[model samples]
Target: MHSDRHEPAPLRVELAGARLAGPAPVPTGVTASRPAAAVPHPTPTQPLSPARLDTPSTWPRRTLLRLVGASAVGLPVVAALAACAEDDTVHPPDPLAAQEVLARADAAAATAAIALAPGSHAALSTIATERTAHADALRTEIDRVIGVYGDGTTPVHRTGALTVPGPGGSPVPASEVETASAQPSTLDGVRDQLVRSQQSAAALARTESGYRAGLLASISAACATQAGVLLT
Candidate 1:
């Protein structure tokens, strides 16, 4: 049977003067003879470092400069597109220049009626009045197309001269001189001439549009009606 009690510690003493005493016995559960070994230390874990922001690798300086140069070169091309868009908004060309020949036929009718139409008063006056009205309408339209009003003091760029074809299919000058040079004829010849001229006017009206076209068409109808009256 082993005893349950722990053993008692031994006493220690030192001798004076001559020599040192021997080491004493150590107590239970206590270490007095040997030095204690150094305690083991725990190592601290290191914190993770943040990632570096590399600018040259992401978008190099050369690449950035190239992008800027490309943008500069495209600016004029963009401006030219804008200019073409503005030009497209300008007005369309005029369609009335060919009708200037009507002035000559109108003058010739006025001249022929006085010598050819068989009446001293109303019949002759009616023919003269219709031709005069047609001439006045032509002049007004000419002024309108040229952007000149009230006697036309200043003329714009003139309309190109009309190619007036005669009975022989030859080109004639569309002038007052051509009208004045026309020879006098009998009443039936005058009626035939006026009817042909009015038919030509009707054909011209079909080529035009808007208010000017309407005016021309009305004049053509009036001329036809007046020419028929001469026949009766």
Candidate 2:
């Protein structure tokens, strides 16, 4: 007697580049289905054009105008900021400048006093010499603070004054040296000016430090002696 069970068909694989022997046979009891439609692949997009990379004309008009406007406004602001930075670095006016001026004025007043009152010649002469020395010392310190460049040239500063001019753009003439209140003699005027110089120097000394403070204090003491002791 023959068996009723059927054997399954063997799988067939075609080699690459080779044709199939014939169409594959469908298994028994399975319905044959139609082949699925081929799916079309999307087309590849082309790369950006190299010629358009630097072409401003290809850019939007509004975008180009905005960029140009930003640059135009930004450049001046940057320049202004640079200018402000430079200004901040600049040295401030030296405090010693006023002291030097006071010293010179005091010396001039002492000299004028000598001519006005012949009896006080010796004392006035000594005061004038000391005041002149004080002015010179102040000038030396100012120069030292300004410093010199690598090329041996002095740094540019507003403190350089070959001659300290008095009020009205001239040396303190004898006539202008007179005090506001009428004094009996020129010695009184000299003494008053010395007192003012001493007070100014003493006040400034309190604010200064190091060598400058010591120097101002010494000058102030000297002015006090000249006004209170020598003049009297």
Candidate 3:
């Protein structure tokens, strides 16, 4: 028989017990790799620089602002000082030397009735005589200047006690002459009045002619000299 020669069942191999023995075998065509290059740690970025502050173009505008501010502070201070130093008192002018001299003569005549100490009466008479002479001289001066004798109506006695015209067609009441002479209780008061009256007379003389000036000046001097006699 040309028969089949059968290999004996390829020597039937058996594993120890029912488990495969020896080391576990690795797979042939597979590999293990690292995570996507580990995403290399990103480096920190740098910050930008700041802008410049001081520039030549802005300097002129700053200077102008400073000058305007200084003027606003200084001008009013100068104006205030100027306002504080002004004087405003006003005095009257000399009347026609003539008519006023008579008024003065009347005032002088009244002086005799005023009570005074011994020897002062003679001095008072002298003053009255001088005032009468002054009246005559002023009459002559008035005739020379305005070509007429000054009637009593003229402004020869416009003392502070006289009421007259003022601004805006208004009439201001005149200030009264403050005198201690009318009825003084004390001698010192009379002397004070005499001094003030003489000073006022001197001021009036300054407003008159050369002759009136001399007369007023003499009267003023005589009154001043007499004041000390009463004061003592």
Candidate 4:
């Protein structure tokens, strides 16, 4: 084997006071890559606080809640205003005394009509006289009730018609009245009218006295007896 000679290791070179050249030369087969200019590091963005992140979305909900609250408060106030508007138009003060007076007058007029019929007999006349007393008593009572309550007059009026009684509350037959002597027929007609009058008078007595007064009960009994007589 031939003797191999080893090359001595390259000695360290030291260049005293030597300046580094302009651009370092690239080594063969190695690319020279310049370090990109340092990219400016942007200041780290502050983390979005929860309050700020949620505030924008919650604003509309908050506005809606306020609107709902205001509507709830205002709805009843609006209803109260409407009720006040209706009350202003519907109510008015009225009189109670005048009604009593008118009722008394009506009873008086009805009694007079019964007493003044042409064919009225003694029995009928007696009932008319009692009805006249009833009218008078009613007038006094009305005055008393009215004096206790009020003196104002109401706008209401009576609308029904009144008539004297005939047979079974019907009109007398014209042929019978014209052909027959009026004396007997008049007595018969008045008898029937007397029955109706007594019945009506007894009813009035009950209404006026409420069956509490001895005088009214006595009058009612007498009227009922007379009604039975006239019917028989």
Candidate 5:
């Protein structure tokens, strides 16, 4: 009798770099194998360095531009403030400025008086001499107070020669007397000028102290004597 059952077909297997043909039996009671759990690789770390640590590199372009612009603007402002601080020095006006002007005017008036009244030459000459002396003394004091530079050169004065009212009620430089072509002033006009000068000196003396006050007081007394006694 012929066999009723047929043998199983041959099994073919494929593997890496190899091939096999055989009647391999399928194993029972074995669990299917899963591919080994894929392992994750750690990311590489960069070394810490100044180039890597610099935060400005990470700043936004707009933010970096703003900071640079601020620094540029602030530098000029700081320089300007420094310059202003250096230029803040102040020079006060000289105290004897008005007195010097008055003395010079008195001298001119006394000299003019002599020319106007030849009969009173003796008294007028004395007055002119004394008045000129007062002007010279005042000028000397002013120059001494002004002081010289390191090179023995006198500094440029801020105060210039002031003007006084002339006999014609117009202003003229204190250094110059009105010309004869102008309105001729009488002895009474000279006396009036002396009186004003005396009053000015007396008023200023009260405000001053020390040597300056004494000088002004002496000037005031001399002017009073010339106006009240000499001119009379």
Candidate 6:
């Protein structure tokens, strides 16, 4: 036999808040209408637009970068200025001082003369005498012209030291010559040096006049004679 009561039908709804058309009182704020679609939030990896950089905090960061960039551009200029200032304080030595050149020549002759043993070489004594005379004549000339006796000293240098850049090496002490020469006897070395010195002095003499030129030519000739004596 069939059941006396029929089973209740299932409730039908289009959405969770769906309601029937009956005039039941709706809630104050809530309604049976569907809620609006959700809006997407900005992602952290997305770049900000130029307009977004108008904040005070952003301006301060940009200003710091500008200052850093300016300093980077200016540093090289400052360094170059400092280098030029340093260069201005330093000066090159005067190369045209006749007193200096003559003084060096005197010192060179004196050094070799002093090294020669007494009576060992008569020619050496003559060379020594001539060099002494040359020094005196130069001093007198200097007194006549510059009115002052220059520093009558030579700067001591190493053996075979090429102090100045020229075909002839600068004259040095006898002991320094011995140190420089490959052989035991430095007579050949001395002769070669004297020849070079005379040649250089003769070149310098062309620029002079009066007593100075005569004296320089005489000295150059005497040095040549001394070099010849060493060969004999």
Highest lDDT scorer: 2
lDDT per model, in order? 0.58, 0.74, 0.49, 0.45, 0.70, 0.55
In candidate 2, what residue range of length 10 has the lowest lDDT sum? Answer: 8-17
lDDT of 6 by residue, 1-232 (tens): 2543433323334332345554456689876776589898886786878888768878988999999999999998787566545643333322223333443453354355445443335665555566567657765665455332134533221122233323245544334433343232345545665677577668768988877778778878877877886435
lDDT of 3 by residue, 85-185 (tens): 44233335335432343325334433633465444556555554555565576566654553322342332222234432222224333222212123322
Each candidate structure's TM-score, on Cα atoms with residue i matched to residue i, is 0.48, 0.51, 0.34, 0.28, 0.51, 0.39
Of the two candidates 2 and 3, the one with more favorable TM-score, higher being better, is 2
- Per-residue lDDT of model 5, residues 1-232, tens digit only: 2443432223222332134554334479875566598898987887877776656766577587998999899998787557545654455545565566666666666666667788888887787789778877777777788786556767655554555544454657655543431333578877887787788778878998988889889999999999899989
Per-residue accuracy of model 4 over 1-232 as CA lDDT, tens digit each: 2333433222212222123334555689998887889989999999988788668677899889999999999998787566545543432211222222222332333344454554444555565455456545544554454343133543232222233223465534323322331233333454444455455444544555443244345544654554566324
Residue-by-residue lDDT tens digits, candidate 1, 1-232: 2443432222122333214554555679986767689898987866643333344465576688888899799987777556545543333323333343553454455566567554633664666666667667676776676564245454334344455545544555556435543666555655665666676667777877887778778777876876687546
Assess candidate 1 and give its lDDT.
Answer: 0.58
Which runs of model 3 end up more than 4 angstroms from their true locations?
Answer: 1-119, 149-190, 204-209, 229-232
Candidate 4 lDDT at 185 equals 34
Clashes of 3: 0
Looking at model 5, which ten-residue stretch has the lowest summed lDDT?
Answer: 8-17
- Show pairs that collide, candidate 6: none
Which stretches of model 4 miss by more than 4 angstroms? Answer: 1-128, 148-185, 201-216, 228-232
- Model 3 weakest 10-residue run by lDDT: 175-184
Worst 10 residues of 1 by lDDT: 9-18
Arrange candidates by TM-score, descending.
5, 2, 1, 6, 3, 4
Instruction: Please say which candidate is ahead in lDDT: 3 or 6.
Output: 6
